[model samples]
Target: MSANSSGVVKVGVIQQANTADTDANLAKSIAQIRVAAARGAALVVLQELHRGLYFCQQEDVDQFDLAEPIPGPSTQVLGQLAKELNIVIVASLFEKRATGLHHNTAVVLERDGSIAGKYRKMHIPDDPGFYEKFYFTPGDLGFQPIETSVGKLGILVCWDQWFPEAARLMAMAGAELLIYPTAIGWNPQDEQAEKDRQRDAWTTVQRAHAIANGVPVVSVNRVGHEADPAGGAGLDFWGSSFVAGPQGEFLYRASIDQEETQVVDIDLGRSEDVRRIWPYLRDRRIDHYGDLLKIYRD
Candidate 1:
C-alpha cells in the first residue's frame, strides 16, 4: 500500500485504567477517543479490554458473562464513534464466539465505520494471578495483517507481544505497522528491582521488533491498579504506552503512573529507507529455519 497523501500520519493510543462497570469504562474510552481525534489523530488505538477491569486476574465462571459477540454492543458503539470522528479505531474485546467458545479478539474499524478484520490472541499466558487459559481459547487466525485506509496493521494482544515469531510473520505478510493492545503489570508482591526489570524488558522487546521488522510499533497498556478479586495481591498496571519508529527510535511515550491520550506523527516513508539500508528480510536464512515449527529438537 502506498503512503497517505502526506508522508506523515498521526496515531493515538488510550492508556487509562478501567472500572468494574462496563458502561463506565466504555464511556471513558469514548471520551479519550474524542480527545485524541480533536487533537488531530487519524487513527486511535485503545488498551486491551477497555470495556471493563482486567477480569483475567482470577478465573471466575461468572466472568464469562462479560464476553459478547463481535458485532455486539461494544463494536456498535465504537463503530459509530469511528464514523462520526472519521478515524480508524482499534479495539480489543472478550469475544463470545459461541456458547462454549470464546477468544481474546481485537477488531479494527475502518474510517468509514466498517469492520476491517480481527485477530484473536495466539499466546495465552497462565501465571500466578493471571489465569487466562480458563477463560480464552487460543486464536485460530494466523499471523495476518488487517489492511485499512491508513495502512496494514499487524495486531496482537498482551502475551503475543513477547514472541518474535508473531512479529516476524506479521512483517513478512506486509504489515506496515505493528500494534499491541496490552494489559501487563507488576506483581504487587515483587520487589521494586524486579518490577523495574520486568518493565524494561517489556519495552526493550517491542523496540527490538520495530528494528527487526522495519515497521513502526504502537503499544497501549492500561494504567493504575486493579485488585485480584480471587484473594491475593493485585497487579499495578504500568502505563508506559509508547510509539517507536522503524529504526527503533522513540516517537512518543506516556508516563507510567498517569492516564493519558496522546497523538504521535509517524513517517511511513521512513520504513522504505530503513529497509533499504538494513535488509534483514532479504538476508533471512529461510532454508535452515525449518526447525522453527518443531515444539522441541530433542
Candidate 2:
C-alpha cells in the first residue's frame, strides 16, 4: 500500500452472472467482496444492480418492487461490510427515492460505515434491449465527485459512461478515480461480428474517458446468458470488467464468460503526471465552451 499522499490504492471489481433469485445474487456479491478485500483491495466495485437480474430488459410496472430506498437494506448491508473490512465500497442499486420517483443510483460507502455520498445516473437509455428511461428519472445530483477515505471517486452508472461531459466534470471537481458500475451485454440475435463490435465500442469509449480526463477508470460489468423472460432473444452479458491507468492502459481484465473478483493496485498519482504532460486541463478554454451545455446546434 502506498502512503496517503502518494495516491496509490488497491482496487477491486466484481463481475457476476446473475440468476432470478435476488437473495442468491446478493449473497454472491457479498462473498465476492470478502474475497476482494482479502486480496488487499482498499476499494471494491460491484456490477450494476447486482442484487437482481437486469429488469430493465423490458418494463413491467410490477418490477417496481425491486426498487428500495437509499438508506434501506442494501446500503445497510454494504455499510456493515465496508466497516468490517475497512475498505471503501461502490455499489449500484435501483433506488426508490419516493412513492412515484425512482433512479438508478450508485452509493459510496465510507470506511467508517457511513453513507459517503451517492450519484444518480444522469444518462438514461431507452433502447430495445435496454429500456432504462421507462424506469428511471434522470439524475439530479449533477456531475459531482463523492468524497471518501480512499479518495474522491467520479462514480457514474452504465449509460452515463458514454458521455465525455460526465467524466470531464468529475475530473474538474478533483475526483482521483473514475468508476462505473455497468450492466451491458450483447443481443444474442446480432451477428458475431456485430457482437464483437458492440463490446469493443463499449470498452473503447470508457477507456477514452480515462485518457481524456487523465484519471484511472474502473468499470465492472455483468456476465453470462440471461434469457429474456418475455422471449424474443436473450442477452449474453460480456463480463470483461476492467481497470485502466490514466494513460488508458489496461491494468487487468476479467474473462468474457466467467464470474471474477479482480484486484489491481493503482498509483493514482500517475494522473497528475499524465495530465501535466498532456495539459488537457491546463489548455482548456472554459470561457469558450458554453456550447457544451446546449442540447445541440442544428
Best by lDDT: 1
- The lDDT of each candidate is 0.93, 0.91
Candidate 1 clashing pairs, residues 3+ apart or interchain = none
* 188 Cα displacement, candidate 1 (Å): 1.1
Query: Candidate 2: TM-score?
Result: 0.97
1-298, model 1: which lDDT tens digit per residue? 4532226779988999888989999999999999999999999999998889999888789999999999888888899999999999999999999998999999999888889999999999999777899999999999999999888899999899999999999999988899999999999899999999999999999999999999999999999999989677999999999999998899999999899999999888899899989999999999999999999999
Off by over 4 Å in 1: 1-6
